[model samples]
Target: MSEKTGQCLCGAVKLTARNVPSTFNICYCDMCKRWAGGRFMGLHVAKDDLNVTGGDSVTEAVTSDWAKRAFCNTCGSSLWYEVTDGPYVGGRSICVGLLDDTSDLTLGTEYYTDRKTRAYDFPEGRKQLTEAEVLALFAPTDAEEGEPE
Candidate 1:
């Protein structure tokens, strides 16, 4: 694990992630493809391990019941995708493209693999999880389900 720093394209939003993993993951979900204009590749970091500067230029939109996506409002650079509520709450996946040095990083997982378009293809033998698998892995726990009113 190492520290990584980066900024938005226009430099309006900057961030530093501590203890970041050397592996990153990709998401091919429809929303991710539309948001990133392709597969969304990200480095998972704990919320507390990520420090942001120029946060005023950042904006987040809740994209799903459990997750939200952030970007630089000024330059429209996708910043990170965060799990807002669920077992993975407090986890944020920073856009790998936003990192300053990613030479050491490698592909870890490919999510929503079934949704990937035929226009592109990654080399075979990579770890992949389909939408159902992803959903099962992150499904809300009993505690998160809340008691019936």
Candidate 2:
């Protein structure tokens, strides 16, 4: 496994992934879109395989049912996608941009395709979905403002 490391734009926070990911996903989830202003690539990183070095300045945001968004407080650099749901099922969706080199690996999988806006078309040639599809798969536990759960 090749070593991968990255830091915020201001160098205030940094992280390292000890091993390369076997699965990569480009998510078009609404929350992701709101967070990144568009699609955010999520590389399935093993929880135990990730380590943060200069992490004191890294900020975390709890977004949903079992998800959290991490970023640099000073630079606002999107860091990693963390899901803390206990040992066996826990994982992190690391940002590919954080890697030292991403020229070798290919895009493995794309998710949250259903949440993409109708105006933007994806180029990955992967399966596509719409808002309804996303709601069907993973809907909010409680009723939304205009929608029923």
TM-scores, all candidates, are 0.80, 0.71
Tell me the tens digit of each residue's lDDT in model 2 across 60-121: 99998778999888878888788756552667887777666677667787777777666567
Best by TM-score: 1
lDDT comparing candidate 1 with the true structure: 0.93
Q: What is the lDDT of candidate 2?
A: 0.76
Give a tens-digit lDDT track for model 1, residues 1-149: 99999999999898999999989999999999989889999999999999999989999999999899999999999999999887888889999999999999999999999998876578789799999999999998887899564
Model 2 pairs whose backbones collide:
none
